[model samples]
Target: MGGDHTISYPILQAISGFRVVGAEECWHKSLTPLMKEVREQMGDGPVYISFDIDAIDPGFCPGTGTPEMGGLTPIQALEIVRGCRGLNIVGCDVVEVSPPYDFEGTTALQGAHLLFEMLCVLPGVQYSR
Candidate 1:
């Protein structure tokens, strides 16, 4: 949910069929509405969720190569993922977790939790842990 200005908008826009939401939009707006818009944009297509740990605030997840300051809080991150409840999700991945920079594995743990949250929303998936 966090895309610092580091991403090249021109290149992202050049992609044939994709939507890009910047961090500012995510931060300022309520996640529920934002996510509703995302769902609308995605339509009925099968979705693949990809979460980068760096999308979370460094205060909550500080183990990535590029830790951006103004990022999503752990709760906010989860809420956003949970908001995808009825989407047709096919797969997902959480990346950019570097244990070396993590304190007591907080980042890793959050990554796992986020993954679980994502799984709970996917079709036919039940969270066991």
Candidate 2:
């Protein structure tokens, strides 16, 4: 057994060299350009996008504890997801959802629905074991 090593684990200690490579300003810009860069860098390989719902504002998605204001709207998120339409999707996981934070279940519903929307885009997705 390993202790939070590799892509399978979340701690990401060995990933010290890993950079938080995108600019916050860029996220507000058109996603197509960034997606193109990602595609070019990936070079005809598989890509997995984890569309975390918490990336949206807490006003609209109030279940997450760390909800950032002025985040992407659902439509914007969908557009970004659709932009990755032709890429080979290996897998993805949307996380950081604290359903308990949303007393009325609003955030949980949005998170689940977003996951469903992602599934709609990924037809051959392997259900996690």
Candidate 3:
């Protein structure tokens, strides 16, 4: 969920078992389309999820190295992680949280929560409220 998005390219390549493709930034009100496309492509295969905190709006995730405007909201970020509920998520991570810049701890809190969300969705995890 954090760190350099470019790193995804190399990681995808290293896996060799999946498609090694570049990622395109998505700016929209909904992520369903993008998620659907990805889910279809994955087709029940084991997948690793990585979320960059920079994907959240700087107002919400200012601690990230690459803060961008018009990024996802904290709510949207949670939904994205939670949306993986039925997928074969082998493992996941949230990255790019720089606390030195997060004076109010908003970004760090969100990053930690997203990481927990990732864990909840992993295959065989017994999710609970």
TM-score of each: 0.79, 0.65, 0.75
Q: What is the C-alpha local distance difference test score of candidate 3? A: 0.73
Candidate 3 lDDT tens digits, 1-129: 455555565356335254432223444456656566666777677677778888788988899777887777887777667777777776677778887898999999888988988888887889897
- Model 2 lDDT vs. the true structure? 0.59
lDDT (10s digit) by residue, model 1, range 1-129: 233234444434333356777777777556888788777877777777778899888998998878999998887798789878787776666878887888688998998888879879988876654
lDDT of 1: 0.77
As a TM-score, model 2 comes out at: 0.65
lDDT string for model 2 (1-129, tens) is 101113443333212221244336545566667666655665545566565666777778777767787787666666666665556556555676675787887767776766666676564654442
* Decreasing TM-score order of the candidates: 1, 3, 2
* Strongest candidate by lDDT: 1
Minimum summed lDDT over a 10-residue window in model 2 is located at 10-19
Stretches of candidate 3 off by over 4 Å are 1-28
Model 2, clash count?
0
